[model samples]
Target chain A: MARQESLNVSSSPARRRGGRKPTISREQILRAAEKFAPEELSIPALAGSLGVTHAGIYHYFSSRAELVAAIAAHASRQLEPPPPGPWEDWLVEVAFVLRGHFSQFASTADLAAIGTSVTFAPLVEALLRVMRDAGFTIRQAGDASELIASCALGGAVVLQRPNFDAAALVEDLQVAEDSPVHELAASAVDDDADAAFRRRLAVVVAGLKASLEAPTAS
Target chain B: MARQESLNVSSSPARRRGGRKPTISREQILRAAEKFAPEELSIPALAGSLGVTHAGIYHYFSSRAELVAAIAAHASRQLEPPPPGPWEDWLVEVAFVLRGHFSQFASTADLAAIGTSVTFAPLVEALLRVMRDAGFTIRQAGDASELIASCALGGAVVLQRPNFDAAALVEDLQVAEDSPVHELAASAVDDDADAAFRRRLAVVVAGLKASLEAPTAS
Candidate 1:
């Protein structure tokens, strides 16, 4: 509970009791962080696992916000989507990459949660940059980025959530027999979910292009 | 909290003590519901406001879930988007209509919350029927619908939440001055929020159109 200022933890690994140095690195911290969900990430808990004080964790990230940002940025860097050739394909690639990331943690990200806006800044930047490269003006890019984020998050929800199941949803519906929903159920054939999401992503990218006749940015 | 079976409530307004009939109607209940946010809605609280026992409220809605669904449906019924002119336009109209509805209560609908999927069934049915009439296969329409829902919900969050302020967000950015995000801020001029959302909705519609060469449903 105490700040433990006596612990001389700084840039490098800290000197423990008896001056024994522990070899900790940014890579080590990030790797350890991977084990916990983003919401579960705690500097004190993390330091405990690494055999260090919370101050030692602070050495790598000056604040908890900084630490979360680092994790987000790290993930962004690791993304290897198809080179931003055609902007639409790039968006599709990024959306799928995001799905992979969302699925990895089995975490439904609460975009409305405090600090989440910052957490997604790296993502928003990457999306905007890619669209800009394709000639979207900052205005166009910014507006479209918000829409794409929505699709990406929404796609993740539809794909991962059990409530979205076609048959189950049909079964749970409160509509009557004469309802068009009954007719709709007959058409609810099984679909390749990944393919379905990619199609939606394409629709979003294509829609963005259609909204802007040509890339308006310099 | 008591059931109060002695209150003698049913389809007609209940007779309170001394044989005086209290004429509480569904319209009265719905008008009152408009005052509370969706998450704040409570049956017992609502009944107390209407001067009815819980059983009397049940006469109108069998359960809390039914009451919520009724509220959702009532809202949906009140929506009058520009008629389904072109399929793209239809989707755009619905998106804007949805924006109006979401903004009315300052609600960001938790599509992931339990029973929300059921609550949205009416909205979904309408969306699918319009797309179907426009010749979209069920699969294309379903996929497109999910993406559009994302845009609608995401738009509400960005437009309503203070955290989305571009200047404030830029100030909070941990990126270096050399970052592209810095350049992005210069282009962050004020925009007509409604127009921006419409453009994105248009984009979504256009993308959906582009994805399918032609609708293949019977």
Candidate 2:
């Protein structure tokens, strides 16, 4: 149904241009969008870059928000979770898939803030399947899915920021060398953002496993 | 030294007013700022609310960014961690304190994005101390602190967005009622944002415990 809707929208330009095939496909537009960072992507700019009129772009995506949503949908389709395996391995693959997706299209983070919940169904389904297979009840699996999705997207936002200098922030705070904040900042300098995210992911996975094993009070 | 610097800035107005004592103090201004949401906070707006001239506002905070930093610093001071206890209890308290702080000042989420590494020093110190007492090495403690902090702050960001209707999003996706996305969205509707966050925090704490007890791979 979504594909049909996308096709109908994309074909409008060709229809208006007297039945000539549309000069551009939705896939081509998304590919062009992929070239710019989320912050730098604008429809007019994208159209200009593609050598198409602004109206041509608008025929497919009515507004920038719609374009962003389409981009998120496109990215979601590209995410190929590894073949089913141990729950732990499955989750690790999920995390890498998410990181790769968000890293490639940074603007998805912004969309997630507003409304990308629907676009995220595929990834959420994959996580849910893994958790359910690992013995989480439906309710538990749902909560876990939300938790993991939120963390991955949130972590991506932190990592994708234009400027994040832990050392500079520490210096601004004027903390002593022995302070915990100083230690954290110094350690952050040693590890890249991706490593830090993976460490966090490990903690989250471990935490979930322990919680699942413990008998619930209810 | 920080206190001296604050005094120097706050006292400038008094000196400019022929030593008659400034009509407002930095504390008074901060008190007013605390009443407004972070996004609503502005130097001129705050000054207007306080019945002071815009110039009077600058006598203390030089810019909106400086004011936000001061607000974060002030919020940090107000975060009094409980005396040493079980690591779980300590982390739970930290999460609540952070959520309370960020919820009270919405813009702190934005600050957390930019430079929470500094503002969060006290809470980080408290968490580090608790983790160390629980037998985590310095490096492990540092990584755990970052993970927990990131989760708490990141969760807060997700919760604080202006409009988040999971059901509406599900409807927009046009998924069948039995579909995994529908199930996830429906389940999400049943759990309030705070409960979801607490669940995630529980997982982080559990993860930390498991990691600490596991024999080091190194």
Q: Across residues A1-218, which tens digit of lDDT does each residue of candidate 2 receive?
A: 55545545665454343444346778889889878777688987997788766666776787775677677666676667678888876786777776566545443333232224324456667777778778886677765665555456546556655466667666655667777666666666667667667777787888878877889912
Q: Estimate each model's TM-score.
A: 0.62, 0.66
Docking class of 1: acceptable
lDDT of 1 by residue, A1-218 (tens): 12222223322223233433335666688789877776678888799888987766776665554455456546655655556567777777777776665444323222332113323356667777787787777777876767766666566556556445555556765566655566555655555667768767777777777766745433
- Model 1 Cα shift for residue B186 (angstroms): 3.1
Docking class of 2: acceptable
RMSD of each: 10.3, 8.6
Residue A66 lDDT in candidate 1: 49
Worst 10 residues of 1 chain A by lDDT: A1-10
Model 1 has a DockQ score of 0.26
Candidate 2 chain A worst ten-residue window by lDDT: A109-118
Q: Which candidate number maximizes DockQ?
A: 1
Per-chain TM-score of chain B, candidate 2?
0.71
